[model samples]
Target: MTSTAIAIAAGGGGDVVAASVLAQRLRHRFDVVAIMSYSWDRLIVDPTPGPRGLGDFDGLTSHHELVAQVTVSTVLRGPGRSTLPPLAHYVGCPLLLMDPVGGVAGLAAQFGAASRVFGAQTLLVVDVGGDILAEGTEAGLRSPLADSMSLAAAVRSGLGLHLLVAGLGLDGELTPPELTSLLQRHGATEVAELGAADVTRFAEVWNWHPSEASGLLCVAADGWRGRVETQRDALIDITDDATIVYEVDAYGVAANSLAANLIATTSLADAEQRVRTRRGYSDIDIERDRVPALARHDEWTPAADTVGAIDRYAYAAANRGVNALTIRRVLELAGASGAGAATRLRELLKCERPHNMRPPLYLA
Candidate 1:
């Protein structure tokens, strides 16, 4: 039997970075295949052309071949511009949409069947944060924990058949107790602080971090403005407002997944209030100051808004489409389930207004 392996790098630059790092490592042992939900177009590029943009995964490693298969639509618009159509039609193999909401599952399953022609597995990864244990009224839809559990259940039983939880970082330094509690609540069997080296070791596993080079793509809103020159130096291709939104959005989504409520702000004051009231911490810390900047700058934005960014970045990768059979191999190992598990999982995956979301941010 071919020792096939799959690695899913979810979220912003960090996910990509983790993917890259892991890809290099896996190349040594197994046929390292990757499923990039967003930002592959921007990450993998020919940097020799010159200075372009940040998060450019150019010339990072020569060992592994990076394959692009699926693409997720930006969350900024409705069905017309959303990624659902193209992703549903083009993916063609055991399809795994990172977060497969209600209408998207049937299509995902269809693709899965097509992929099975060549032998593959389909999987999905969802970030629920800390909103799971609430009432299922409209208000609960926004609950992070509930949302994650719901999505996990849906994929577990649905066409996707495999699910993984992404973005579970705690705001401040997580005490051991807090980490244990967080893990127990999420039903995760293992957790690790991701770094460059870990990527290679877990490259063959269904659940592993992306490459560190991928993390280069992440830019905080505040850092983008201040570090524009630095970013320009790092990336191989730089254009007018090259899509930096994906990193911001991914980071925001990941942050929201851990917090109790939806962290949002139209202005700096709103951000401060959200942090103060929800997180219950003084805004005097260095990291706290960084949060506002990350939100305000171009690279960082609220997770809900960052959907557009991820779409723009994935445009090219989606066009290429990787080997569907390889994706199926990865999904089989993920071991995710579907909707029959609970009512809470179904409710969380539905789209709803952000304000109605729950848990309130807990400031560090």
Candidate 2:
């Protein structure tokens, strides 16, 4: 079988970490290529003398070794023009742009053969923030959500696709049922929830590097293990601020696990409680509120608007036997497929007019 050429579009350190883990797991089946759209240099640089910059890239060493040789590129130019790197410049084979929120599909289409080779299988992972959605327009491409939904619908019409939502933060009130319903509405056929244990397993399989092996020992000795055990139960009931903290701390521990003295030992419950308490402080909350929005949906209405665009396109495509895919098809392939939320969103707007007040179909 021909090797799948996969492209990962990562923005932050966390994104890079996730992509690296995925690359390691699929190395045998794929020729993985990573396209980083943000600058790690700026994120890490700090004027202060003590431990400056954000931190080293997590899993950098392992990524260099186990995964297909990784490549890093910045999407933005300086602090202004937020456009991503032209996707036309990177096309060579079947491609999948991870989190191509900022108009990457349009750019990819410009590559002609690359876009056709990937076809409806071209996928993008959508997050709550919608950064991928925003980048679509910024890069002069159609909305990523629209393209994703179209692809999903097409896949559903033909092959049996499945969806699996893994590594969802356990700190929020979002339930498996809720997620399943949402995915189903968008055209998914399955939906599964993953927990901390699953995450740990993924990390191990990826052979992540340890920054401070000794710090992990210190954390274990400092009762971190007991704390973590106690917090496991709390993780299930997480709905408020406490749970959020627990989730963040858990993520931090997971990220810093490479440090010998910094092993994450705190129970999910205690970590949650600590995070809640910390957030309670006026200064902390105030500072956190200042953090810039990472996803485009937080500010732009394009993603939401594109939901209708996708529905219209799907309906038209179905009528014409175009074999278009929708979000549901993509999720089905991922394993945690369902479309309850997407269906409801469409229904709710059934009677509403399109934002531009333009007819659903356009003719040249």
Measured by TM-score, the strongest candidate is 1
Q: In model 1, which range of ten residues has the least summed lDDT? A: 355-364
lDDT string for model 2 (1-364, tens) is: 3244333322222333333333344345444443222222111111111111112222121221112111233232222211122221222222222221112232232222332333422322212212221211122211122222222222222322222122332212244454344333444322222223323422321111111111121222222221110111221211121111001111221222111111121222332233334333221233234333212112222245554565575466446543323222321222211123223333343445333111111110
For model 1, how does the per-residue alpha-carbon lDDT over 1-364 read when each residue is reduced to its tens digit? Answer: 3233333333322343333443343345333333334321111111121111112322221221222133333221211122222332322221222322221232233234333432434332322122222222222122122232223223322332323332222111232354345445444432222332443332322112112222222221112211111111121221122112111122223333422232222222333344345445322233434433333232221344332432332343334431111111111112111112111221331233223211110000
Per-model TM against the reference: 0.30, 0.29
**Which is the leading candidate under lDDT?**
1
Identify the runs in model 1 with alpha carbons over 4 angstroms from their true place: 1-14, 19-32, 36-107, 110-118, 122-179, 185-188, 191-195, 198-364
Cα lDDT for residue 185, candidate 2 = 41
- Model 2 ranges off by over 4 Å: 9-13, 35-164, 169-173, 183-364
TM-score of 1: 0.30
